[model samples]
Target chain A: EADIYQTPRYLVIGTGKKITLECSQTMGHDKMYWYQQDPGMELHLIHYSYGVNSTEKGDLSSESTVSRIRTEHFPLTLESARPSHTSQYLCASSDSWMLSVPQYFGPGTRLLVL
Target chain B: AQKVTQAQTEISVVEKEDVTLDCVYETRDTTYYLFWYKQPPSGELVFLIRRNSFDEQNEISGRYSWNFQKSTSSFNFTITASQVVDSAVYFCALSGTGNQFYFGTGTSLTVIP
Candidate 1:
């Protein structure tokens, strides 16, 4: 099945710990995005990648960074975690050349920093 | 600048009743796209419908229908004969350059059986 996947659906970590949220898609999409959302709140874009070796920050400023080493993989890493970083991280991918296609989303990873 | 707005914060309707979720958007690009997504308790977004700037045609799928009005800058979704499964957070989004999507705050819906 071609779908987006995120690892460690739920995570709990202490503040100052280093963490990486993994995201992969089997759909072979070229554009991938990472979004942060609080429980029952709106989603905010944090990072995105156009393709391999291309990454960019999103509208909302985030302490985490992302890398796109492959077309199907985009991972986000936080050097030092904080309580403020506790939120659900969602991964999405869309076709590169399609203008009207909707993005395909993966089940979010819920992180808790104590 | 691209922005999407869902004026209704929350709504509750009894089963079998009809419900409508409103979506308004703003953008400078002449060519753009609009989308609606459903987020269930599982927290994954499911795409419902997509429309373009030039297409004003209304669409219906099963018990769901969408109204796209470029004149009012609105693209609304209506679910007829609501069911418990229809309860979820509905979001409206706008893609101005097709590279970025601007999402609304989302409207949470509850259906009472």
Candidate 2:
């Protein structure tokens, strides 16, 4: 089993509320990523980090922001949650510093903004 | 631009039957990588297999196998004697230039027992 964990497996919040989705990995991986996926749809890369203090935007633009202050923790925060942000958020980690490495994923957090 | 396409949106197979998932990709980079991931109803992705661009050899593990063909730009997955537990959404991905990964629109497989 993968050591990666996402807190609050399910969340239901009202619009304009502040929400933070936490992701932590105990595997000591150097690369981490955040993806947004809808039911029966493809996963869209929203954010990723090469390492601590390194963050980059992904192919799909997102309103949420991610921070990589610690190696094991990568947190995503939405300042003002909206109905559009209601989707499943997936967190993943890769051991390899290079791309194309197989990634281990955590049980995604399903968010619903009312 | 790198893209992965899974033409079949859903596939149904009875227990002990075999099913193949089609994946076609487009990439200009010669040193790209193709991947297959399985996502059950639980909503977590499980890495099934990864194939580098230089390797065109077919790979098989247990009852699962992958066929990679550079000529057709396709990486297909086949499962033999599939069980009810094999029911899930399968996604094909491509990691091309800059290590960016692109995912397919997943194929939902239902194996009725």
Candidate 3:
């Protein structure tokens, strides 16, 4: 199994609340990504980080922000969450050998904003 | 920009039957990567296969096989004599030099016993 993990497997919160989804990997991977996906739908890249302190927004412009303070930790924060932010968030990590290396994904965090 | 398209939204096949999933991609990069991932009921994405653009050779692993055709810009997956355990949502993805990965909407396959 992959050594990646996501906190708060399920969350239900009222609107306008700040929330953060946690992602941690023990594989020491340099690349980490945050993807937003609706149930049974495609995954949209929301944020990605190449390494520690390196972060970039993905193709799908998202209201959330991500930080890579430690190599094993990449957390995404959403200030004043709204119903539009209700979706499953998947976390994945990969090593430098990306050509042949497949990304390992976490269990994913399911969020429901009221 | 790299994009992957899984035209089939859902497919149903009886157990012990064969099923094929189609994946079409668009990219200008000479070298890139294609991948297939399975998301089961557990909601965990499992890496199924990865094929680089340079490698056009088709691959077969047990009941799962991948056909990569550069001429048509298509990479199709075939599952022969599939079982109920094969039911899941399969996604086709593309990644280029920048470590940016893009995924398709995915095809949901159901294997009925």
Candidate 4:
């Protein structure tokens, strides 16, 4: 089954702790994105990658950073977590072309900074 | 700037009833794409349907149907004979030529037994 996966489905950490959210897709998609969302709120894009060694910050300014070392992996890291960073982080990937090319999302990792 | 608007914050319907979710979009580009996704309580986003700017052809998948109207920049989804399993949050999204997407706040639907 080709699908996107995120690790640590739920996380609670101290405010100053450093954490990394893992995302991997076996679908071999070239475009991958990271979005932050609160419960029942609109998704806000935080980072994206076109391919390996290519990454870009999204419209919403975020303190976290992402890396695309491999096509199947795009991980986001926060050097110092804060309470404001508590939210659900979703990972998505899609092919470049198609009639719609709707993104396929992962199950998401819910983070709580205490 | 591309934007998507879903005016209905929440809706409730009885099982076997029909319901419609409205989506409106704004974009400067002539060509763009629209999409609908369902998020259940488990928090997984499921892709439902997609429509492009040039094609206004309505589509039906089982009891689910979509209406796309380019004139009004609207894309609406309707579920006929709804069931309890249809309860979820539906989101409408738009993406321009740049490949960046904008999404609506979403509409929450609840189906009563």
Write down the worst ten-residue block by lDDT for model 4 chain B.
B94-103
Better candidate number, 2 or 3, judged by TM-score: 2
Instruction: List per-prediction Cα lDDT, in the order shown.
Output: 0.93, 0.94, 0.93, 0.93
DockQ values per model: 0.75, 0.78, 0.70, 0.68
lDDT of 3 by residue, A1-114 (tens): 689999989999999999999999999999999999998789988898999999999878999999999999999999999999999999999998556678899999999999
Provide the clash count, candidate 3. Answer: 0
Q: Kindly list the per-residue Cα lDDT of model 1 for residues A24-69, writing each as its tens digit.
A: 9998899999999997788899999889999999989999999999
Taking the tens digit of each residue's C-alpha lDDT, what string does model 1 give over B27-102? Answer: 9999999999999999899998899999999999999999999999999999999999999999999887846889
What value does DockQ give for candidate 4?
A: 0.68
lDDT per residue for candidate 4 within B32-53, as digits (tens), equals 8899999998787899888889
- The regions of model 1 sitting more than 4 angstroms off are none
Docking class of 2: medium
Clashes counted in candidate 1 amount to: 0
Model 4 lDDT, residue A104, Cα: 92
Judge candidate 2 at residue A89 and give its lDDT. 98
Which prediction has more favorable DockQ, 1 or 3? 1
Provide the TM-score of the second chain in candidate 2: 0.99
Q: Is candidate 3 or candidate 4 better by DockQ?
A: 3
lDDT of 1: 0.93
Instruction: Please tell me the interface RMSD, in Å, for model 1.
Output: 1.2
DockQ score of candidate 1?
0.75
lDDT of 2 by residue, A19-85 (tens): 9999999999988999999988999999999999999998899999999999999999999999999
In terms of lDDT, the poorest run of 10 residues in model 2 chain B is B93-102
